[model samples]
Target: MSEEKNESTKDTKNKDKSSDSKKPSRRRSVGIVLLGVLLAAILIPLGVFVVAYATYDVPEPEEVTSKQVSSIYASDAETELARIVPPEGNRRQVELEEVPEHVQNAVLAAEDREFWTNIGFSVTGFGRAVVGQLTGDGSAGGGSTITQQYVKNSLVGDDYSYVRKARELVYSVKMTNEWSKEDILAAYLNTVYLGRNAYGIEAASHAYFDKPVSELTVEEGALLAAIIQLPSQLDPWNDPVGAETRWNYVLDGMVEMGELSAEEREGMVFPETRDPAEYSAYTEATGTNGMIKNNVIAELGEVGITEEDMTTRGLQITTTIDTKTQEATLDSVEAELAGLQEDARAAVVSIEPGTGAVRSYFGGDDATGWDYANAGLQTGSTFKIFGLAAALQQGIPLSAMYDSSPVSLPGDIVVNNWDNSDSGYTTIAEALKRSYNTSFIRLQDDLYNTTQDTADMAHALGVARSLPGVPATLTENGGQPYEGIILGQYQSRAIDMSTALATVANGGVWHETHFVERVETSDGEVLYEHEVGEGERRVSELVAANLLSAMEPIAGYSSSALAEGRTSAAKTGTAQLGDTGQNKDAWMIGATPQLSTAVWVGTADNTSAIFNEWGGNMFGSNAPSAIWKSTLDGALEGQEVLEFDSPGQINFGSAPNQLYYDPVPAYTPPAYTTPAEAEPTEEEASEPEPVEEEPAPAPEVVVPEVPTPDEPEGGGIEIAPGLVIPDFLTG
Candidate 1:
C-alpha cells in the first residue's frame, strides 16, 4: 500500500513540471507579437518622412546678374537729367573681405546667434516653431538659420507655407553641402534690403551713412544690421525712434555674443543718418522726373512694355521736357522765392499750345520725389474764365451788363468784390478784367442757373483731372453746386491750368497733355513714339477770340507779368485759406500763341500768409506773376511771337430795364427837434423850431418796381443806352 502511494505523488509532481515549462513558451510567443507591433508603429512614419524628403527637389542657386539702369533725357533726347533703376534689386555687391569684421559679427548676432555652430537645421528652433504653431502662439520663435534664410530668400522665395518651409529645409541642407559657409554669407549680405531703395550692405552703408561698407563703424554696422528685419519701418528718414530702438537692440546683442563688451557699448551712441533726399543718385533728379517717369511708363504700357520691362530691360526714355526751359523755370522760381519764408513753395508748368507737349515744369524747391505741378490747390479767381466762356458760348456778348455789387445767393452766401467796393452797372469785359465776384455770379445765374455750362467749359478746356483733397464728382453742372463756383471755389492742378490756357491759345482746340515723346529699348528699338492726334474743338473760335480780347488787358495791368514785345493774355487768382482770412494760394495763368505757362505760389504746409512784406499783396500779380513772366521770357526767348486775331463784331441788342435800386424810405422824424419849453427861450437854440404838426403825413411808402416772375430783380444792374458810367463811379 505504501509503494503505491509514493508512485502516485511522483506522477503528480512530473505533471506539474510539464505545465510550468509550457507556460514559458506561450509567454515568449506573446512577447514576439508585441515587439512586432512596436516596430511597425515606429517605422511607418519614418518611411513616410523619408519618402517626402526624397521628393523635395532642391533648386540650384541662380547666378546674380548686374541690374540694368534706364536713362532719362529731355525733349532733345540728348540732355540727361537722371537715371532710373528698380527700387528692389538696386544692390552694389562687395567681396566678403571688403565688409568690416564688425559688420559681419553684428549681423550674425542680431539675426542668427548659431550661424557658425549650428547645422543647416536647428532642432530646437524647429521644435519651438512646431509647438508654437500648435499652440497658436505666433511670437514663439523663428526656425530659420542664416543658411536657411539665404536659401529661402534666394532660391525658393519667402513664402510662408508648410510646403515652402519643407522645401526651405531641404534646400538649405543641400546648399550647405554644395557651397562653403563663407560663400553663403557673402550672397546673403549682398541680397538683403536695407532702406531708401538700397539693397545689400554696401548700398545700405552708402545710403544711410554716406560711406562705404569698409568705413562703417561698429554703431553704424549695428544699425544697418537691425534694418534687415524691417527695412521700410526702420528707415531713419521715416522712423527715427524705431530705428534707434532696433539699433540699440543689435548693439546689446553683440555684447551678449562677446563680439562687443558691455564697457565698449557704454560709450557708443546711435549714429546720425544722412538725409534721404541728399543722396547723390537722387539729388540729381528734379521733381518733374516722377511725373515724367509715370507718363513714360504709361506710354510704354500702351506699347505692351510694362514698368517691369523698362526697369529690367534697360530702356531709354525721351521726354518732351526742354532742358533749357526746365532749368529756367526752376531757377526763376527759386530766385523769386529765395528771401521769402522757408515754407514758401512754387510750381510752374509750360506747355506748347499747338501740340499739348509739356515743355518744362518745376514742381517745387525740392523736386526729386513729389510732383507739385500735378497736385491741386484752390483755383480762386482764375476759374472765373470758365464762367465767362460759358456766357460767351450762350451768345451773351462781352458787352452784357451786370451789377458788380454785394449780392446774396440761395444758401445765405453773400458775394462781394475783393475790396468790398460795388460797381452798380458794368460790362462783362470790365467785370472780368476786375474779377468782380458778384459780376461773374450774376452772369452765371442769368446764363445758366446751374453750374453745368461753366463746368462743361472748364472740363472741355482741360480741367478734367480730379485732385487729391477735392471730391472726384465735383463739377459745375453735376453733383451739388457750390455757391462759390463762379468765383473759383474748386481745386485744380497747375498743369490743368496750363492745359486750359493752352487750349484757349490754340483757337479753342483741346488736346490731352502729355510729357513722354518717345521711348526706346537698350538696343535702340523704338518701343513707343507719340503720334499727335487731331484735337477736339471745345469752343467757338469767335468766343475764344472774345475771351482772349478780354484777357489781353490783364497782362498789361501788371508790369511784372507783361511780356515785352510779345502779345499775351493772362488772369490772376487768390484764394482765402478756410476761415483764416489769409491768402493761402496765389496763381497766375497766361499764354502767348507760342507757349502757355501757369505759376502757383503757396506755403508747403498750406498755411501762412502768401502776401507778406517780402511778397507783395497784389494777389497773383506779385511773386507768381513775376515768376511766370521770367520763365516765359526764358522759355520763348528765340521762339516766334504770334498775334491773337481780332474778334468779329457781334450785335448786342438794347439793354434791359431790369435794374437793382435802393429801396425808398418812409420818413418818421425831422433832422432836428426843439423842446417846446426852449422854443421861446430860443437864445440857446440855433436851429428852426419844429412844428407840432400831425406826424408829417406818413411819407408815401414808395414801393420799388417789382419785375415779373420771368425777370428776377435785385441781383444785377440794368444798362441803358447813352449811359456813360465813369470808372470812379463803378466798383
Candidate 2:
C-alpha cells in the first residue's frame, strides 16, 4: 500500500511536471502561430505592392522623349546638306542593325558577360557592388550589368539617390520581364554615344573609318566599343591617344574574356582618316538645276535649313539631282568656260522630261560668293522654241511656205533674216532650221493680232514668268524694236529654261522643277512626296515631235556647225542688248535623250561688243556655238550611243515657197601628172569665165523627191550610221 501510494505521488508529481511543460509549450505554440500569421499578413501585402508598382506603366519622364535635330552623325553622309535622327534618352531605342558583330562582341566582353543568363540585375554582381561601395575600394569596379545600366537610364533621373536606385531596380525587373534581351541591346546601340558627334555605333564607324559598321574590323570594333563608357573622353576621332589607351583596355578585357587571341590583337591596326574634308567645309555644294551652291544655300536658308544645321547637325538630304548627269553637265560647262575669256561667266540647267526632276546644273564661277546662275537673263534665241511651237500649234505643216523677205510692222519696225538676207520665200522647215527671223515674225503677226498673242505663246511655254509686271504700254511685240520678240527678247531663269526644254523632251509636258524629291522626318515620317508633274501635259504630242525634228538638225544631221558628230540637238543665241550693262547674252540649249543642259555666257555689264565678237562678218554663229559644241563634246564622253526618236513621221503637206538646187562642186585635188605634168590651158585655168552675178534667183517652187526621215538627223545630215561615207561626204 505504501509503495503504491509513493508510486501514485510520483505519478502525480510527474503529471504536474508534464502539465507545467504542456502549459509553456501551448503558450509557445500560440506565440509561434501569431507570429506566423503576422509574418504572412506583412509579407503578402508587401509582395503585392511590389508587383503592382513594378507592373505599373509609369509615364516616361519628359527627358525620355525630348529630341531635337542633333549632330547625330559626324561624317558627311549626304553631300548637299546634313541630316538628323532620333535619340535614346531613357531606355535604349531600336537602332539601325548595321553594327558589326565584332563590335557587339567587344562591347559584350567589356560591359557584361553573363548578360544573356541574368534578368535585370546579377545578384553576384550586385552583392559585389554593395561590398565595393561599403569598402570604398572599387575592387568590384561598379559591377553593373548592361540591364541594370539600361534600367537606371530608363526609369530614374541620373541622381545617385537610393530612391533612384530602388526605382531603377523595380523598372529593370519589369523591363526584363516584358522585353527581350535583343531588344534591350538594340536600344543600347542606338542610344549610347560613341563620342565626337557619333551618337551610335554606326555613326562612329563612319566617322572613324569612313565605312559602315558592318564592315568594321576587329581592331576598329574594339576601338569604337571602348568609347561607350566615356564617349567624349575616348572618342577615336577626337582623341586618338586616349582612344588607343581605352582601346587597349578593351583589348585586354577581350583577352581576359577569351574573345580574341593575343596574336589577333597584335595584328590589329588603327584605321587612318581618309578624308578630313568629309568633316570639314571643303566639300563642293554645286547646284542641281544650273543653280550654284551659293544660290542653293541662300534658298535653303530662306526655307529654314540654317548654316549650323548644314555644317554640324549631320542632316541627310537626298536631292533631286542625278549624280551622273550633274557631274557631266558641270564638266561640260567647265570645259566650255575654260575656252571663254576669263572675265566671262556661264551657267547651265537641266531637268528630266516627264519627272521635271533636275538632272544637272552649272551655276558659273561668278557664283563665288552667291549663286548667280539661277538669276534671270534674256531668253535670247532659245526662246524661239516657243515661237516654233506656236507656228506648229496652228496646224502649220513643216512644208508650209513663209515669206522670209523683210517685213515692216505696225510701228514701221522692219525685220529680216539674221543677216538681213531674204530667204526667198522659205518653207517653215527651212526657216526653223535656219532660225530665220522674218519668217517667225510673219507667223507671229498671223497668231497675235494684239499684244496678248505673244503673251499667250509665252504662257504656253512657261516663259510668261519673265513677262511679269509688264504694262500694256509694253508692246507684247517683245521689245522696243518689236523684232526682239522674234529675236528672243524676253528673259528667263535657268530653272524655267530647263523646264521648257523638258517640255520638249517629255513629249510636250512642262513640269515644275523639283529639288527635294522626298523629305523624311527625323522619326521616319515622310513629310512630303513630290510628284507634282505626274499627269500634266503641256503640249500635244504632234507639236513636240515636230519641234524635236526641227531641233534634230541642229544636233544630229546639220547639228550646229559647232556640234557635229555628237548625237545632240542644240540652238545658239547671241542677244545684242541695248547697253553696256546689257551685254550680248550668248545662250545654248542642248540635249540628248539621257540629259539636257542650257549654257549661258555673259558679262554682268552686258555689251553689244560681245555680240560683234561672236557674230563677225558671218552670221550670228560664232562664240555661242563654240561654247555649245565644246560643252556637248566633252559631256558626251563615255556615254552610250543614243539617237533621238521622233514622235512620228514628220509631215509636210504642200510644196515649199521655192525649190532651190545647186550641184555640189566636185573635188579636184591638185592634178598630179608625174614631174612632167602639163599645165592647163589659159581658157581652162580661167575657171569658165566666172558666171555672171545674177544673185542666183530662188529655184522654182515645186515638190521633189525628199529623203525619208530615217536618214538619222545629225552628223551633218545623217547618211547611215554604219554606211561608209563617200569622198564627197569627207569633203
Candidate 3:
C-alpha cells in the first residue's frame, strides 16, 4: 500500500513537474507573440503615416507672377524712364515650360536624380544624409528631391536639420500627391536663387542674359542652374572661375544624364562677360552725371532709403532721372564753367515746374567723387527772385520806384553796385534788370524788415533757414551775411535751388522733388504713386511774370549780358565773402520753355576758380554762359522753340497807366558824365531834349503786361493793375 501510495505521490509530483514544464513553454510562446504584436503595431502605424503623407494630395502652390512695366512716353531722353512708369519692385514668376529643359534636367541631375520615382526621401540617400550629418560632412551632397526643396521652402523656413528634413519629406509627399509635375517644376524654378541680385530663375535669366527665361540657351541655362546650388559662391561676376567650373560640371551632368545631346553640349560656350544692364530694370548710361549721388546719400535719412538696401539687397530703382536731360545739364555746366574755375565755383539745377521732377541737374564733380553741384552754397543775385516775389506779394509792381544810391543800414553797412557806383533813381524792374546791390538792400530793409517778408518769401520758395545762422559748410565767403539781398548770400542745395526755380516755371506751384517715380512688387502691383501738391506760392502770377520779365535782359540782347540767341531768362551772380577777400561764388540761373537750370562753378576748397586764373569777366556769362548755350542748343535740337507765357494777370488791353514814381529832374548833371567825357563834351552841351520830332513812334516797350489784381487770387495779394510804387531800390 505504501509503495502504491508513494508511486501515486511520485506520479502526482511528476504531473506537477510536467505541468510546470508546459507552463514555461506556454509563457515563452505568449511572450514571443506579444513581442511580435508590439513590433507589428509600431510598424503598421508608421507605415500608414508614411504612406498617407506620401500619397496624400496637396494643393499646388500659387503661380508666381509679376507686375508689368508701363511704357514711358516722352521725347526727352532724360525723361524716358519717367514716361514709362515701372510697377515698383517686381517679383517674377516662371512657368515650367518657360524654363529650358536643360535647366530642369540639370537641377534634377545635380540635386536629385531619383526625383520622379522616390517617395520624397530615398532610402539610400537618407542613409548617406545620416552619415553625412554624423560626420559633419554635408559635402557628400543632399538626397532631398526638388519637390522636397520646394516643400521645405514653402512649409519650413531655412532650418536644415534631421527633424526639419523629416517634415520636409512628409510635405514633399503631400506636395507630389497634390501638385502636378509641372507645378512642382514651376515652384522649384520660382524659388531658386540666381545671382546678380536675382531671386529666381526668371529674374536671373533676365539679369544674366538680358532675355526671358524661355529664351535661355543650353549654356546659359546650365550656368543659371549651377547658380541655384550656391548663388553667392558660384556667382559669375564675383566668382567667375568657380562659376565656370560649376557650369561645366552642370553641362557634364546634363550630358551624362542624356538630357543634352552630345552636339548641343559640345556647342555650349560659357559667357565671358556679364553686362549689368542685362538685369537692371533701369537703363544705364555710360556717360551718367553722378553729381547727385552724394546729395542723395547725404539726405538718404530724409528720403527713407537705407544704405544697406543700396549695397546688399538687390534694389530696382526707378529714379526720376532723365539720362539725356541729365547729360545736357552736365554738358551745359561743364561748358559754362570751362577755363574760369579759378575765379569761382558754379552749380546748376533744373526741375519740372509742376511735378518737381529733376529733369536736368548738373553738379560739378568727376565720375568718382562727391557732386558739388547739389552742395548748399551762397546764392548771389538769385535771391532777388524770391525777394522781388516777397515785395510783389504785397501789391508792389515793376513800375515801383526806389532810390538807387548807396544806403547805410543800422549796422552802418553801406552797399553799392558791382561798379561801386549807383544811379540816383530807378524802377522796380530797372533795379532787377541792373542787378543793383544797394537797391536790393534798401528794399529788403523796407519790405522784409517790416513784415518778415524776406523770411516769408524764402520759406515760400523752399529755402530752409541756415542752422543757427550757420550756412552750408561749402558756401561762398564761408557763409557770411551780405548787404546785397538782391545778390544771393544764403546757402542751399542745387536741387532745392532747381525746385525753387521750377516754382516760377510752374506758375508758383511747388512740387516736392523726387528721384523715384513708383514702387511695385516684382509682380505688377502698384505699391505707390507720387502726386503733385501745390506748395506756398512765393508770388502771384503777376509777381512771377514781373520777375520773369525782369530776367529777360540777361540774354545777349542786353548791353550788360553774354548769352546769345537762346530765348532765355536768366540771372548771374558773383559773391565774395564779407569781411574777407577769400572765397568767391559765381552762378548762372537760367531757363527756357523746355528746361530750367542753375550753374555754379567754384572749387571744393572755395579757393580755386574755373580756369585757375582771373580777369574782369567772372560772372555766369563767361564760362557758365557758354556751357549753358551750347548744351541748350544741342538738347533742344528737334523741339519747338517756345517762351514762358506772361502771367494771366497782365491786361495789355487797358488804358496806359501813369509812371509809378516822380520823374528825375530834366537837367544833365555835371558829375554824372561818362568816362569818355570826364570833362563836358561840346556836343553834349549843345544837345537838348530836341523838340519831339513828330511823335517819335512810341518806343516799343519790351516788358510784358503785369497781371491785374482781380485774377483768381492764387498767392496772398489783391491790388489793381495801375502802376504801383517801386520799393526795391528806395528805403
Candidate 4:
C-alpha cells in the first residue's frame, strides 16, 4: 500500500513540470506577435509617405500662373469701362535681387518669422491641421510656412480633404530638401496675388505705389506682406481700417522676430497707394468719358483711401456714372459746340439729387488737357442764385425793391447794365430773373453790413471747394468779398455748380458728391458698398423753394425741359473777358426735382473769347442753354419724369416795384410762348454786331405778379423814370 501512494505522487509532479515547460512556448509566441504589430505600424506609414512623395509631381499652378485681368465698370458692373492691367498683363516677374532687403524681411515677418531657419513646415501647425481634419472642427488649418504655402498654392492644390492636406505636408518636406530657400521664396513671390489686380511682388509694388519693387519703402513692403495672409479681405483700397490693423500686426511680429525695432514699428505709417486706373494700359481713353476715372480717383482720395482700398482690390469697381447719360452728354456738348469757333470748349456735369452721384460728366474733348468740368471758370449771373438765397435767409422777400440803374462804387468804378438799360427800381425777383447786375450788387450790400454775405451763401450752397478764390471768413481759405461775387465775378466749376443746384432740387439737402457706387472682389463678394445717407441740410426748404420759384422762368420750357412732366428752374450767365467786349465764359445751370445739370462754354486755351458760327459773341442763353437742353432732352428721355416738390408759395411781401418810378403794365408773354420764345428770333440768331456793341444785354426779367391792396390793382411791372405806357394796356 505505501509503494502505490509514492508512485501516484511522483506521477503528479512529473505532469506539473511538463505543463510549466509548455507555458514558455506560449509566451514566446505572444512576444513575436507584438513585435510584428509594432513593425507594421511604423513601416506601413513610412512606405505610404514615400510613395506619395515620389508620386506627387508638383506642377506649377495653372490658374495662378496664367495672366488674369481686373476690370472697371460703369454704374452697371456689366458695362466694363476698362480692363485694369499694364501692358504686361498686371504681372511681371522680378529677380529677388531687385527687391529691397527690408521689403523681403517684411514679407517674412508677416508670413513666417522662422522662414530662414525652419525646415519648410511647422510640426505644431501641421499637427493642428491634421487634428482639425480628423475631428471635423475646421480649426486645424492655416498655420503654414512660406514653403508650405507655396507648395499648397502653387504645387499641390488647396483642397479641404485630408488626402490633399497629407499631400501638402509631403510636398513641403520634399521642396525644402530639393529647392533652396531663396528659390522657394522667389517662386512664391512671383505667384502670389496682391490687391489691385496685381500678380507678383513687382506688379504689386507698381500697382500700389506706381514704382518698381526696388523702390518699395519699408512700410510699403510691410503692407504687401500683411495682405498676403488674406489678400482680398485685407485689401488696402477696400477696407483700409482692417488692412491697417493687419499691417500693424505684421510690424509687431517683425519686431518680435528681431527683424524690425519696436520703435520703428510705432513710428511707421501706412504708405500712400496709387490709382489702379492709372496703371492700366487700356485706361488712356481720351474721350470725355475718361473724366469719370479722374473723378473716381479724386472721390476715393477724399475718404482717406490712397487709391483702391475700397475702390479697387483686384476687384470690380462700379462707379456712379451712368453709361447712357455720359454718352448723351458727350453728344450734346459736341452738337452745341459745333459750328462755333475752333477755340471753343464746352463742359457739362449732371448730378442726381439726394444721392450726390455725378451721373453725366464731360470735361472736354481732350481728356488729358485742362479739366473744364472741375477747373473753375468765371461764373456770371449763374451766381445770382447764391445772392438771392442769402437775401432770403435774411428774412428779405423777393419782392424787396432795389435800384437797377447805374451806380458808383467807392473806387469810382461805374457799374452799368450791358445795354445801358435802367429800371429805376425793380424787385429782387425781377433782378435775379433778368440777371440785373446793379440790382444784385446792391442786394448783396443791403443784406449784410459787409459784402461777405454773398460769399458765405455761395459756400453754404456747396460751391466753396470750387470757389476757393472767393474770400470770406466762413471759408478757412481767406479773401475779401467784393460786389463781383454777387454778379458771378468769382470763378466756379461746372461740377460744383451742378452740386449746388442739386442741393436745392433735393429739398435743401447737400449730399457730398461721389463716383464709386460699390466695389466687389472677383468672386462677387462685396468688399465695399456705398450708402446714400441723409445728407447735411445746408439750406431750409423755404429758401430752396423760393429760390427755385425766382429762377423758374430763366430757362424756358419750349426748347428744353426735363422730359415733359418734369418742372425745371435754371439761370443763364456770361462773363466778359475784361473790356474786350467778348464773352470768355458762358454758363447755363438748370435743375429738375431729380437731377441738376450745369453747362459751361468757353475758349479751350482760356485766352480767347467764345464766338458763334457767324462771329457773334456766344452768350449763355444760346450755346450753354442749348447744351443743357439737349443733354436733358436725351438723358431724361426714357427715365421717370418727376415733379418738383413745392414748399408752398414763396412770400409776396408788400414792396413796390420801384421807389420813385410809377408802375407800368406788365409785359404779357405771348399766349403760347415760354421765356425763351418771348425773346425775338433775331436776338437768338446772334447776327454779328460791330466790335463796339455794348456788352451784351442781360436777360429780360419774367416777372411773377403778387396782388397787393395798396391801390396797385393794375397788372404791371416797374417803369423807368420817363418811359410811357403802351396805349393798348393803359387805355
Candidate 5:
C-alpha cells in the first residue's frame, strides 16, 4: 500500500510540470495572432492610400486635340519656300488605320511588349523602377506602360520625381479609361519627336527618306521606331552606325513580337538614306529658304503675331522676293567670286526705288547663317554722296571750285589727295569723279552747317543716322560727324546704303524699305498688305537732279562704269582695315531710274585683307564693280532703260574768294646799273615836290591769325576740335 501511494504522487508532479509548459506556449500563440491583426490594420489602409493618391482626378488632354500648319510662299504666292510645323499641335496627325500594321507593331515591340493586355501600371515594372530611382541608376529600368508614357510625355511631363511619377500614374489610368486604345496609339505616334526636327512619323519619313509615311518600307518603319529612344542621338544623317544598330534591335524586337518573321529580318539590310542636304530646308536655318523663313517670322512679330499664332494659327506669308531676281543676284556673286580665297565673302542688295521693295539680295555664302546685306560695314567713299547732297541743298553748284592740293584745316588736320597726286584746282563734279579726298574735306568745312548738316542729309536720304560700333558719347554729334565723315568713315549697312541711293533715283522720295509685300491666313484672308508709294519728301526735285547730274559721269564711259549703254550713276568705295595697312572692305553702289543696288566684298573675319594673287590687291573698282555690273545686267535684262530727267536751273552765287594760292617762282632782276643816257622830263621834278607835301595813309587790312595745334601729350594727332585720330590711323 505505501509503494502505490509514492508512484501516484510522482505521476501528479509530472502532470503539473506539463501543464505549466502548456501555459507559455498558449500565450505565445495568442501574441502572434494579435501582432498579425495589427499589421493588417496598418498595411491595408496604406496600400489603399497609395492607390488613391496615384489614381485621383486627372486633367483632360486638351493640347493635342487641335492643330494647324503654317506655310511660307514666294512673291508669286504659288511657290512654297517652307512649311513650319511645331512639335505639339502644329504637327501632322494621322488616324490609327493610316499607320501600317508592321509600323505599329514595331513601336509596340520596342516600347511595350504587353501593351495590348497589360494594365496601365505593371506591379513588377513599378517595383523595378522604384529600385532604379533608389539606386541612382538613370538607365536602370522604367515602369511606364504605353498609356503611362503618353501621359508622362504629353500631360505631366517626364520629370524624374516621385510626385510627377504619381501624377503620371494617375493620368495614365484615367487616360486609358477615357480614350480608346486606337486613339491613344494615334496620339502617341503623332506627338513623339523624331530626328532632324521632325515631330511625327510622317515628318520623320519625309525628313529621313524624303518620302511620305505611306511610302515607307518595313525597314524604314523599324528605323523610325528605333529613333523613339533618343531622336537626336540616333539621327541617321548624324549617327549612321548608332541608327543602324538601333534599327536592327527594333527589327529583332519585331521578330520576337511575331510581327516580322526571322526570314524577313534576315533578308533586310540597313537601307541607304538621302543626304541631309536634300532635306536642308527642314533641318537648317541657313539658306535661301531659311532667309525667307526667318524674315517671315520677323515680319509676323512686327505685326503683333505671336510665334504661337504663327505655328498654331496656320498663317500663310507672301514675300516680296522676286524669284528670278534673287537667283540672278546669288548666281552673279558666286560666279564673280568663284576664284576668291576661302575666307573671302561678298553681299549684294537691290531695291525698287519707287516702291522700296527689296527685289534681290545675296547674303554671303548660303550656309554661313549671316545676312551680310543687312550687316554693318565701313561705307568708305560711298558716304560722300550725302555730303555732296548737303552742299547741293545749300545752293552749292557742281561748278564750285576747291584747290585740290593738300591743305591744313583747323586743329592742324591735314587732308591729301589719293596717292598724293596733286591736281591744282578742281570743280565739285571733277572732285567727285576722281574721289579727291582733299576737295571733300575742304568742301565740308566751307559748308555753313559742316558735318552735322551732312549727317542730316544722309538721314534724309535713308542711311542710318548713327554709326555702328561707335561709343554713345561719340555718336552724340550726329553720329560723330568729324572730318572723316566726308570720307565715309562711319559704319553703314548694304540695305541702308542701297535704299539711300534709291531715294536719289526716286526723285528725292524716301520710302521705308521692306521685304514682305503681304501676309495672309491659310483661308485666303489678307492679314496684312503693304501699301505702295508711301514716302516722305526728303529733298526737292531740283537737288535730286543736281546730285544725279554729278553722279552720272561716275557710270559714264569710264572703266569703272557698271554698264556701257545703261543709264546709271554709281560710286565706288574702299576702306582701310584698322592699322593693318590692308584694304579690308570694297563696295560699289549705283542706281538706274528703276532699280538701285549695292555690293560689298571683303573677308568674313573682318580682319584678313582681300588680296588676290592674280589680280593684285582687290579694289572696289574691280571685283565689286564687276559683280554689280553682272547682277544689274541680269536683273534688268528685258526692262526698259529709263532716262534720268534733267535738272532745273538754279543760280549759284559768284565765285568765292580764293583761300589758297600756288607760290610763284621768286624773281631776281638784274642788278641796277647806271643809265647809259639820262633824259630828264620837266614834270618829274615838279611831281616829286608835290608828293612830299602829304603821304596818303595805306588802307588798313585785318588778317585773322590761325592757331597751330599743340603737340599731342600722348602720341595721337588731335584732328578736330575734340576728336583725336584713333590708334589704328596713327600707325
Candidate 6:
C-alpha cells in the first residue's frame, strides 16, 4: 500500500513538470522582445543624430558677402537696368569694435541679454519664459540668441516651422563653435535692418541722423536698437509716436542691464531722425528706376526667393520693362509737363495684352517718394469704358439711346455732362463720343439698374481694386454698375487702368500684372522662370467687343487719339476738383490689339487742380492723351501694327427695358429705322382688327439693401447666389 501511494505522488509531480515545460516562458519572452524594441528605438535615433552632427558642415555666410552684389536686367536680359536694393534698405558692414559699448548693451538688452554668456540658444530662458507667461509675466521676450538670428538671416531663409527651427538650432550651435562671439555680434550688426532703407548700424546711423555710428549717443543707440524690432514702422518718419514708446522700452532695458545709470537713463530722450526720403540709401537710385529695383525685390519674394538668397545665390533678374518704351515715356513726360505746374504729377504704365507684362512705368522723379504710378487716384471718364461693358453684359447694346439730360438724385447730387450740355435722347455711341455724364448716370438707373452691375463689370474687366465692397478685385480673386464708378469716381492706379484695358484687348481675359521675367544663378542654374498664365475671363468676348466699339469712336473724336494707323480704342477722363469746376485728375486709357497704356496727370496733392497755361483745367485729351499716344507709339515703334478682333455681331437692340417692377423703356429706336417705302402686305393694307396689348410679366424686384443717407451701403451681402448688392455705392 505505501509503495503504491509513493508511485502515484511521483506520477502527479512529473505531470505538473510537463505542464510547466509546455508553457515555454511566454511572458518572459514578450518582456525581452519589448525591451529590445525600446533599446532599438533609442539607439537608432541616437545613431542618426550622431552621424548627422558629425557629418554636417556649416555653410559660410555667403549671403553676407554676396547680398550687395546683384544685377537686375531689362526685358532683353542683357542691358543692366538696376541692382538688388533690399526694400528694408542698404547694408554697410561694420566691425563690432566700431559699435559703441552702450549700443552693444542696448542691443543685448533688447534682443538677448545673455548673448555673451549663453550658448547659441537658451533652453532654460525659454522654459522661464513659458513659466513666466503662465504666471502672468507676459513681457518676457523669446529665447533666440544673436547667433540663432544670424543663422536665420544668413543660413536658413525658411519658415518658422519645426524643420527650419531644427536647422536654425543646428546651424547656430555650429556657428558658435566656428565663429567667435565678437564675430557673431559683428555679423548681426552688419546684417540687421534698422529701417530708413538702412541694413546695418552704420547705414542706420547715417540714415537716421546723417552721421556715422562712432558719434552715436547712448539715446541714439537705444533708438537704433528699438528700431530693430520693427524697422518698417518704428521709425521717426513713419511712426514717431510709437518710435518714442519703443525707445523708452530699450532705454529701460539698458538701465536694467546695468549698462545705463538710472540718472543717465532718466535724462535720455528720443533723438531726432533725418528725413527718411532724403537720407535714404536708395536716394542714389533716384527716379523711376529705383522703384523698379524695389519692385523687383518684391517680385523675387513672390517667387519664394529671399533677398538674401538672391544675393547669396548670385541670381540675375530680368524685368519686363522695355528700354525704349521706358525712355520714351520719361521723355514724353518731361516734354509735356514743361509748361505745367511744378507740383503737377504724372504717371504712365503700359501692359502687354494677354501676358500682363509691364512694358513701361513712370512713377515720380524721386524713387523713394510716393509711387504715383501705383497709387490710386479717382478715375474719371476713362472709367466709362467699364460702364459700357457692364451695360452690354446686362443686355444693353451699343446702339441703345439714353436720356442725356442732367441726372438728379435723392442726396441732392446731380451728375452733369461736360459744360452741363444736354444732348437729349442721344445714342450710346454719340453719348460716349460726347462723354455725357447724365447719359451714363441714367443708364445706371433705367438700363443696368444698380451700381453693382457696372462695378462688377469693371472688376471683371481688370479693375484690380476692391469696389464699394463686394466686386472681386482682379488682384484679389479678381464687380458692377455703380453710377459714380461708371463716371470714374472710384480710385484706380495707372497700372490697374492698363490692366483693365489690356484685358479688353486680350479678348476679355485678365492677367495679373508682374515685373520679373526670370531668375538665373551665377552658375547658370534656373532659379525661377516666369510662365504666362491662363488668364481669368472678366467679360465675355462679345461684351468686350461691343465695349471696344463704343470706345473706338470716342478716341477718334478726340485730338488726343493714338498715333495715326495705331488702330486703337480709348477713353479720356477729367475728374472735377470738388465744387471748383476745375479738373484734379486727367486720365487717358487706350488699348491697341497688342498693347494697352494708362496715362494720368494730376497734382501730387490731388487737391490742386491741373490748369493749362491757356487758363483752363486740363482735360484728359490734352497732356494725358498725348502722353498715351507717345507711349504707345514709342513702345510699339518696331512692333507691327495689329488690328483689334472684329466686334461681336450682336445687335440685341438695348437693355431689357421691359424687365422691371415699374418699367419705362430706356431704349430709343433710331430715327433712320422708320418703315422703308416698300409696298405694304395685304393684311397691313386691310383694316387691322383692334387687339389688346398684354401687360409684360412682372419681374422679381431685387430691392436690395439700398444705401440711404442713413445706413452703410455695401459689404458683400448675398441676396442670392451670384447676385450681390452694388459693390461700390447704392442708389
- Give a tens-digit lDDT track for model 3, residues 1-731: 99999999999999999998899899999999999999998898679678857664565465422232222212232343221112333235645777777778877766777777776667787778778888989686567678777777666657856567766777777776667777777777776656565656776777777777888777777788787888777777788888999888888888888888888878778975467644455432222233343333333334565544343223334456566666676666555445444333445566666676666555444433334454445556666766667666656666667887766654333444544456787876677767776666666665634324554455555554442123322122443233333455345555555666666766665566655555433334554445656544444565566677777766552222322455666766554432222224556666675666776655554433223234432444445555666555666666776767774443322212211211211111011112121221323211111222222212221222432111000000001111111111111
Alpha-carbon RMSD, each predicted model: 17.0, 18.2, 14.9, 21.1, 17.7, 20.0
Q: Can you write out model 5's per-residue Cα lDDT over 335-435, one digit (the tens) per residue? A: 87788877778878888999888788666555325556655566767777888888877778888888877767664455555345577788987888777
TM-score (all chains, Cα) for each model? 0.56, 0.62, 0.67, 0.57, 0.63, 0.56
Provide backbone clash counts, one per model. 5, 21, 65, 10, 0, 20
Question: Where is model 6 more than 4 Å wrong at Cα?
Answer: 1-66, 86-284, 447-449, 467-482, 653-731
lDDT of 6: 0.68
Report the lDDT of model 3 for residue 105.
85
lDDT of 6 at 200: 75
The TM-score leader among the candidates is 3
lDDT of 1 by residue, 92-124 (tens): 567788899899999998788877777677889
- Looking at candidate 1, the ten consecutive residues that score lowest on lDDT are 722-731
Tens-digit per-residue lDDT, 1-731, candidate 6: 99999999999999999989867787789889999999998898667557766776875543346244357888999877766554444665556778899888888887888888877988876676557656868667565788888778877875857567667777777778877788889889877877666777887888888877888999888889988989988987888999899889888988888888999887766788877666546543657776777677777786799867765554678889989888889988988888788777788988888798888888777656656676656676777777677777777787888987766654344444555467689887778777777777777675444666666666556665342222323221333323466666556667778887998888877776788889987546788888887866666777777778778765666665566577888888776554333567788888998888899998766656786545455777778877888888877887787787777665664333221111111111011111122312222211111211321222222322432111101111112222111112111
Determine the C-alpha RMSD for candidate 3 after optimal superposition of all C-alphas: 14.9
lDDT of 4 by residue, 514-543 (tens): 777886664457756788998777767777
lDDT by candidate, in order shown: 0.69, 0.53, 0.54, 0.67, 0.68, 0.68
Q: Order candidates by TM-score, high to low.
A: 3, 5, 2, 4, 1, 6
